[model samples]
Target: MATELTAPPGVRVDAPAIQRRTVRLLFVTQIISGIGVTIGISVGALLARSIAGTAVSGLTQAASVVGGALLAVPVTRVMTAYGRRPGLVLGYLAGAVGGLFVVLAAVRGWVPLLFAGMLLFGGSTTANLQARYTAVDLADPARRARQLGLIVWATTVGSVAAPNFAAAADATTRRAGLPEYAGPFGFSAAAFVLAAVLLFVLLRPDPLLTARRFAAPTGAPDAAVARTPQAGAPVGADAQLPVGADAELPVGADAELPVGADAEAGGPGPARRAGLLDGLRAVRSRPDARLGVTAVAIGHVAMVAVMTMTPVRIGESHAEADVLRLVGLVLSLHIAGMYALSPVIGWLTDRTGRRPVILGAVMVLLAACAVAGTAGHHTPRLAVGLALLGLGWSGTMVAGSTLLSESVPVDLRPAAQGLSDLIMGLAGASAGAASGFVVQFAGYPVLTALAAVAVVPLLALALRPVPAGAAGAR
Candidate 1:
């Protein structure tokens, strides 16, 4: 119930506190949505393989990847216009529709229809990705990292359960005399519906709006505005203003302004423009951003390369269908590693800083690539490599996100995040398509080796000393 305080035009002051209920609701909604998205991804690939034959599965996946890349800009614009809630709700609805189409395609064995369904379903996954940004909207500056981390961690529940859901779908569909492939899509649809309902009902008052309302006052003298409730009250309640509510006092009347005040004190115009320009400029001028982007982009390329090629490679080696099952298992393990330690990564970033984590993650990624490139033909070794790859991905992703957050002001955060995700989507899409070609020609080992080499410049950049003023630039 703290009084709403406006900072300088573009600078946003951290809110007094985030409500526990709000956080819990957002977390739960994201978890449910994540499960739906994962189910779609896990099953969609298999369905594509089934309908179009293994030879064309890569093409189908590439279509979905390209679809995701195409969707990013429009999705971000929608979120900007309507706020994340409506965008998310609409995204879920789109996914549900897509799921139904998948089920229909499976019933009819329509390859083109199945591919179209997958492209539509990809929206769900994109929406879930945007959920992390929403989680940070209401968080205090001091707690933003942890808040983002928590949302990322929440995805673990869904990711870990997704494969089981796929298995359940397989069983249930067969029992019901329906096409086996339809079951996962059905389950995905239900989960999306549930998530949509939860979001519609629970995300009250809008976290972003609440944060804006509760922020510390800016520019005006303390005496001009009334003090609101205690620091710990629920965000939107009205509190009593202090005695001199209308009286203007000296500029420095109160000591110990809230956190993020310095940035807030500057008038909004310059800061807003700077925040926008800073993110773009960082990509161009700062080695850290550039290197981080390169590492992530290459890691994604390597991941898609090995992952898309694995089942084919195993089949060529005269492996059983169970080896395909092993791919699913490995993927599940990989996802677990990617999301399970997010909170820990967030805490570490907050405590130790982002550069060290980035460097460490790069090292792990390098090692993982080496393992996959050399020893991964063996089952056990492959499993280990995939797990390490997942862990490395998690570290780099969390660290990179934290770094981006630190580099940009809150107002421009959404745009910056959107841009980053767009880049990632493009990179992942290109990699997914190219990996198949690379494996078709160059072999998996060479592809992984190239991925390993991609990280070297990033590592070198991480090793460089920060200039004196760079610390404050963020």
Candidate 2:
């Protein structure tokens, strides 16, 4: 039997080749998964409204968001133990089951079942969110955002198109005895299944595992120091791990450095496994990493708050005959805004720096709120505002994600990354749940105003001066 090739000391491996292959596989899988997720999200609120009424309609989406956050723990654990391929496959498969449950719930008008299904359906989002991180597991630091952005961009096709197919999917499923709003979810379930199968079959060499294999120590004397854990910077109360893969410690600072694959794997003397609190501590130890998590969380909150209520707003003022078409078009545009320009955003993040792009995102989000808030029933204005909302979301997500990934050492990256997503997802879930009440009581405009206010902290954080050591890592 043939063995896999390995890179020896002083010989750089074909990491670029592996990275390219990984990106291609991730891109295709992202498209498939994006379609599944967007189809379900597009009508999740509407379905909830039909069964549970507007008062609690937001709960379904909130459940999904929370599900995505909660699921990240296990999914990332899988990634940490096994590899990216299995982790992603696990998430997608779970999502497929959730989608089916949602369809069944919709048909039976079972509110509890619907929420449960949506929560499980959140697995797809978990997989989709993590896929971006997978793209950069072996990427060059300089082009990290660009590569991550490409995977994000791939979602544009499926996400944008899926909303437009809402009416068609609804009609098709209705004929098959499914409820009006349940057809999209039926399609969503099948899409998730296909996505899982595709990844299981073609995501070869498992990018995270491959990167771990290549990053193992080569027994050089200096490499020993890199692996040694020093007792400073407070990564955790009981643990003192590395500051980051590329972080330069200050004078007398005892932060540890990157670990080789041996430490990551459960070798004879394996390193301690990082927990969620450790990941939070890791973020706390670095200014840039804290800012990264903040940016992603705040951006997600603002986007979800306003978006969760838009369909409801349109339904209120628009003619019934036009509601479906307008909702689909607006959501399609919003989804496009979120994903269509990600590549450019990624390139810009790499060029101008993550902080600048994050600041820009805050500005765009505020602009989105301003435009959307005042639009009233004007369809064109609302569409444009939603587009800006998505654009801002893309900018923050790409830059923040890149900064977080690079700001932590490889050993702690998965945990930190998962924690960041958890925070972001929780923020979004809060916003999503509150949006319905805000819109119901104060109107859609008020919801947008609150969403705008949420970005203030992110703006302040982005404007803070970067320390010399942290700046070097970016």
**Best model number under TM-score:** 2
Residues 318-348 of candidate 2 have per-residue lDDT tens digits of 8899998999799878988888899999999
Scanning candidate 2 in windows of ten residues, the lowest lDDT window is 218-227
Tell me the lDDT of model 2 at 12: 24
TM-scores of all candidate predictions against the true structure: 0.78, 0.81
Q: Please provide, for model 1 over 1-474, each residue's C-alpha lDDT reduced to its tens digit, 9 standing for 90 to 100.
A: 113344323222223323344567768877787787777777666777777777876566566566565565566655543455666677777778778888999889988788777777767766676677676665544455576778888888887777778888878887998686678888898888888777766665454434433333431111111234443222222222222224321111121122222334532211122222344554555554555455556556556656666666556554585766777776767776677888887787667767777788888888878877787468667667777777777777777765664443333444556666667777887766677677778888887777777667778877777776552122
Residue 44 error for model 1, in Å?
1.9
Give me candidate 1's TM-score against the actual structure: 0.78
Weakest lDDT window of 10 consecutive positions for candidate 1: 248-257
Error of 1 at 214 (Å): 6.5
Candidate 2 stretches with Cα past 4 Å from truth are 1-12, 43-58, 104-110, 163-186, 216-272, 471-474
